[model samples]
Target: MTSRTFAAFLQRSLEELKEQGLYNTIEPLEGPNGPTIAIRGRELVNLSSNNYLGLATDERLVEAAVRAARTWGAGSGAVRTINGTLRLHEELEEKLAAFKGTEAAVSFPSGFACNMAAISAVMGPGDAILSDELNHASIIDGIRLTKSTTIRYRHSDMDDLRAKAREARDSGKYEKIMVVTDGVFSMDGDVAKLPDIVDIADAHDLIVYVDDAHGSGVLGGGAGTAKHFGLSDKIDLQIGTLSKAVGVVGGYVAGSRELVDWLKARSRPFLFSTALPPAAVGASIAAIELLQESRELQERLWRNAAYLQQGLRELGFSVGATETPITPCMIGNEETTQLFSRRLYEEGVYAKAIVFPTVPRGTGRVRNMPSAAHTTELLDAALAAYAKVGRELRLIP
Candidate 1:
């Protein structure tokens, strides 16, 4: 018999998830996460990675990382509050501010930690946050960390936000009020109505926060979602990741100099967590510079997305409303969604199925992320595999 410990609860919980068909099996890629990846010796069209600009394996980024690693060592020696603050990190932050069009920026080890550090640093028990219903898990967790009251508005519903904001402000039960949202919903790929959101925030005198983890390097001509909507100057905080489109690993909060300075003094992550490796910082700087210099990569990403979207629609598969490179082929049943993903893998496409909890129940889908590196032939191959699997499962006629 197994020994009594926390293992029982954990084991039972995992078992329940598997029984409910919610347990996911992770597939380890044999090589870099590029437009094409090898799994068990088979090369497949990789539509599962967040490397939107294909910089993860870019030669320039690789060279920059190698140079930094050679020059700065493999890891940061300490946390930012200590001696871990390196020159490369400072330069990266500078470029980050420029790219996001902010007065200053502060970097974190990851996007999740950035949210945790930034959100909790600003608000507390007496304050309230008006968050979007569809914000990322990181934001939700961050809100939970603070002793603040959270009021969730309907996703992209400006009227709902207005109502919530007014209620929070008039109740006089809170000292500060802020609104937070994902600039682009990762699941459905729909953009947030930032102009309307900004308008509501202005009218209610609420601080505005945007987590543009999926929008940077994909929108605003590669600046970000706030810039895409021409409201960068109006947003109180603009959070973004260096991992997804930048093809590196880090996160940042871009805002006014005073806000950044406050975070530098108050954020727990920056105070306690180790700084990002010099390689990541260097590569991110290079990636942002590249993005600023050219729109070619962004154009390629959009073209690839359009091609796949059109192909899926023509094949009778229901591709959900996506305004970006993320394509969600909806399959309402959970088990079938998992099976569809597996069949697609067998046919040489590597899109993953997202089900309950990640998305609402009865809205399972295979979330495909097309990248700039995908050749036309590779995309065509992916379309063919999707058609084969979708038809085999009777998901499409």
Candidate 2:
């Protein structure tokens, strides 16, 4: 297409989104993403950040980063297989494996890359993946990239999962089968039924992969979802992000020594992409140490989540089946959800609206991520704002 036609098409696409109240404009944050953040010169209670333990700005983590950077420089300079394998990288992997109760661990620059690399490296054209319908975008993309036949089980529906697993196992079309799910669904805050999933996996002799991106620092006494369910030894592959509760930038997969060795040898991302920065790896190690040493932060995080979820429900908003810190205030319709988020921000609460593609078209919501750093006063203030906006929009009484 010519420039004029291409421009017209882009304009039409944007206009369509705007008309449906689905256009998302990025707001620049001026400070650290903490309990409170500055956006457009306004301070708001930050409920959109993934810093669950509030360690993104923790002094110890900062010190660790500074020390590592002073000693090792900023970048890794090459992929892990090359010269990027610094001492900090090995230390971080050892720490992660210990924390996850696994024999070994391998780091990736990002969780998405880890999924892509791990999935594509382990499974391919003749293999099959029984994935959760609500699995993260990265998992879906990774599975797609593997050229594997993917069978999407209904979200958290054991019956659907069993049906799909049975069909896939009995089909005789694939050489191997894997079951993939997020330990905690990011949007709904519900915990995955790992025990049931494990049973199913055992019954079918399938490889079990759990992406505990949202559960690591907040569950299993800070060990993660597998530990939370006391099934650490039973889980095959556990993928987690250092960027979430760990408050650092990177991802890791924890498993048996042989599996980790396989990833280190065959994963393209680990082979081709630069390793995580020295600072990030150092800070992540410190974060894991903190989590393993104390349950205080995790306790506070759950307290805050419970308080906010209860308050919202009392105000008559439908907080979905959340068993974790992610609480979604279900306000149907894209326009209404956007208006709700705008009103909350206007009232000094920085909650974002979830619209189509992130969620189903008519199931738009305002997702609240309550963190350990948010004080009661802050939570109360946010609740008041949510109540006000909810009332104004007739979302609640």
Candidate 3:
């Protein structure tokens, strides 16, 4: 039976969230999440998916998934450390290692799990982690799971990071110090200052961890942010997601063979959570191979992103300081942002609003992701929708 206290707490919390305009109402998509989506019998141009290279719905990947399902059954049937580590898992890890130009790699069920597993496995009470203030929620949660001290430096502030590293190092209160940051900030789409971060880590003998979730398959010819800055060898841990640009599912940490070995041995998620299913593994392998085979998809993605971003800018919408394809159309008010997204839906666009907890208050936005699968005609139509909504909301002149 449900506890009365628990029920009351849940009711009060939900009411508070609703009054604050923080309740997120999810709408189901009627079909595959691709360049376009169907909702309530209406087809809309989808600009909210992380399918950067559009491999999620690619026929090749779909066929690979189907083949894998047939070959390996529906599930791996156990946790990885038990009996679930299939040959496909090994193959996917190998492909990831090759893709990231690392000596080895280890996979996790999800990108969020990678953070929870890796950070807690390697860091603890005797160590300290210097994190970027604007790091993802998963990172923050991972830091919370650790008993280690966490020092947050200002977002992308290299000087603050250096000072924190120096202070932590000089204090000598910890045995190990790691500086962790996202390779590409998801919200703002700005690339991390990896060269500077690497330099600071080198100066202070700090282990470097980069969660390149948003950079993989979009930067460095699709190798990722570390490779983009030619610092692949310098970064101690390079984390990436198969769900994003790879257009599959799962996550991995690519680094030295010793690091991968340590993670395989100690990471809790890899030990307890069920391994990625054969279908996702196969699709991920195909996606990585496709990325390695040619830069055509990436080129298409960049061109589409540039076109959409330019269109928004020309429409007098602020896109923020985005170095990658993730475009955020800034709307300072939460209600307005939600209304703006609803207006877009009515106008045949499917970009969603990001507000409150996802971003800082008063920094709400409608995030647009232009994928490789989208045609110029689709982008032009999306732009037209944006223009209409902006005018209707008085968000643009």
TM-score of 2: 0.98
lDDT of 2 by residue, 265-351 (tens): 999999999889999988998999999899999999999999999999899999889999999999989998999999998899999
In candidate 3, which residue ranges exceed 4 Å CA deviation?
Answer: none
Candidate 1 lDDT, 158-204, residue by residue in tens: 88998989899889898899999999999999999999988988888
lDDT tens readout by residue for model 3, 1-397: 4799999999999999888877888999999999999999999999999999999999999999999999998999999888999999999999999999999999999999999989998899989999999999998898888899999999999989989999999999999999999999999999999999999998999999999999999999999999999999999999999999998899999999999999999989998999999999999999999999999999999999999999999999999999999999999898899899988889899999999899999999999999999999999999999999899888889
Could you tell me the lDDT of residue 249 within candidate 3?
A: 92
- Full-model lDDT for every candidate: 0.93, 0.93, 0.94
Count clashes in each candidate, considering only residues at least 3 apart in sequence or on different chains: 0, 0, 0
TM-score of each candidate structure, all chains considered together: 0.98, 0.98, 0.98
Candidate 3 local lDDT, residue 301: 94
Please tell me which predicted candidate would have the highest lDDT against the true structure.
Answer: 3
Weakest 10 consecutive residues of candidate 1 by summed lDDT: 1-10
Q: Model 1: how far is 100 from its true place, Å?
A: 0.8
Residue 329's C-alpha lDDT in candidate 3?
95
